[model samples]
Target: MSIIIITGGSRGIGASAAKQCAAKGMGIILTYNSHPAGAESVVRQINAVGGKAVALALDVTKVRSFAAFRDDVAKALKSTWGKDHIDGLVNNAGYGNFNAIEAVSEAEFDGLLNVHLKGPFFLTQALLPLMAAGGHIINMTSATTRVATPGAAPYAAFKGGLEVLTRYMAKEFGPRKIRANAISPGAIRTDMTSKAFDQSPEFVTLLAGQTALGKIGEADDVGRVIASLLSEDNGWVNAQTIEVGGGYNI
Candidate 1:
């Protein structure tokens, strides 16, 4: 059985992707940071639907814990699926913080860096040995990296860094037949964007205007794309950053 690990699989795009991938008959090892109940609920839903899934707790910012996490993943694979290797890794765990560059404190910057870039980097490295040949890596980035958004300078910057890292990962890991790609999502109606949308109708209108598709995105909109990229049909697609926005700011 082909198994995949998805970080932050408890809610939003992560949860949607987990369900979609399971529907395609893939075994899932999903991780959550603060929402065990949410993660368990997702697992229950998947299993109830005749899919296989397991949820594990993980803090993406804690790079030091990656080795232990990898061990846990290996054990889960062995016990649950009778496998020692996984076919894909989705680095999707992240938090959004809005702050202008001048107002961004050192701690805020560090936190974003740790989760967005540093954690994914080391986590992939730690798990590489156990990743099967032809395995794929999907990094979750943001459309902010493409079109600059005010009050999100640091967050956008780090996401941009992850985009560059995606290409480098594809380059270095090519010999192993491992492909790396990034999914850059536009404004989605997840918890992350609820406040912004609720606070200002004008803001919502502005975002919708920027999108050629004439609306904000839903979590499933982006999730399905991520799942598709991980499938064998997209096996030749590599080192690309596919934007999942509704043609935002285009």
Candidate 2:
């Protein structure tokens, strides 16, 4: 079976992608930050359903820890899947914050950059050696890069950078037959956006109306797309940023 690693697999889009990938008969190595219990719960669910899965702790912002994390992944691969290479890597761990460019502090900006941009860049570099030929890399970006949303300036800016990086990865990794793509979700109902959905029904309604589907998306909507991208069926689709937003804002 093909083995895959997904960062931030404890909750939100990452968690959903983990489960969906497992359902596709792939062995899973999922990472969590700050929530071991949630990671364990996901592993338990996957095991209960007869799928193989393992969860490890990862603080994406801590670049110093990546070597240790890679060692742990090496161990997990050998012990669990009896393999030396991973077939897929999803850079999906991130948090959402809302602050306008003028109001955004340096600390806040650095925090987002560390997790969303720098973290993914270095982590992928650290793991690139273990990635098998024909492996796929899926970077979870945001549709905010395309749609100008108030108070999401830094987040969108970094995500836009990630989208550009995805193309570069595809170009550079093409010799190995590896592919890279970006998945951009629009106004999904996830833990990151739950507060907005809960505190302001009008905000949710406005977003829904902006979507051509007349509704917001669920985590699995994007998760399934990630799984499909990892599969051989999409082997020819590379260097693209797919918007899984149900056609938001026309």
Candidate 3:
């Protein structure tokens, strides 16, 4: 069976992607940050349905821990699936912050850059050796890069950087037959957006109206797409930014 490693798989899009990937008969190595219980629950759900999954702790912001994280991944691969390499890596671990460019502080900007851009860059570099030939890399980007959103300057900027990095990864890794792509989600109904949805009806309405589907996206929607991208069926697709936003902002 093909094995996949997903970062930030404790909740939101990452969690949904783990379950969905498991359902399709892939072994999952999911990472969680500050949500071990949530990660355990996701593993339980997958196991209850006869799917195999293992959760590990990973703080994407801490680049110093990546070597240890790689060792842990090696151990998990050996014990869980009796393997030495993973078939895919999903850089899906991230958080969102709302602050305009003028109001954004340095700490806030650095935090976003660490998690959204620097984290993915070094994490990929650390794990690149473990990714076998034909492996795929999926970077989670945001539709905010395409359509400017107020109060998300830093977050969007880094996501946009990740999108560019995805293309570069594809170009550089092509010789190894390892494909890379970016998935830009639009207004998904995840915990990341819960505060806005719960606190501002007008903001929610505005988001819904921007979507051609007349509803906010769900985690599973983007999760399924990510899972599909990792499948062999999409082997020919690489170096592309796919916006899974229900025709958002069109």
Each model's lDDT comes to: 0.93, 0.94, 0.95
Across 97-202, the per-residue lDDT of candidate 1 in tens digits comes to 9888889999999999999999999999999999999999999999999898999898999999999999999999999999999999998888677877899989
Query: Is 1 or 2 the stronger prediction by lDDT?
Result: 2
Question: Model 1, poorest ten-residue lDDT window?
Answer: 187-196
* Residue 137 local lDDT, model 1: 99
Instruction: Output the lDDT of residue 224, model 2.
Output: 98
Candidate structures ordered by TM-score, highest first: 2, 3, 1
Give candidate 2 misplaced runs (Cα > 4 Å): none
Give me the displacement of residue 94 in model 1, in angstroms. 0.5
lDDT per residue as tens, model 2, 127-220: 9989999999999999999999999999999999999999999999999999999999998999888888999999999999999999999999
Give lDDT tens digits, candidate 3, residues 1-250: 9999999999999999999999999999999999999999999999999999999999999999999999999999999889999999999999988887899999999999999999999999999889999999999999999999899889999999999999999999999999999999998889788877889888878889999999889999999999999999898999999999998999
lDDT of 1: 0.93
Best by lDDT: 3
Q: How far is candidate 3 from the true structure (C-alpha RMSD, Å)?
A: 0.7
TM-score of 2: 0.99
Best first by lDDT, ranked: 3, 2, 1
Stretches of candidate 3 off by over 4 Å are none
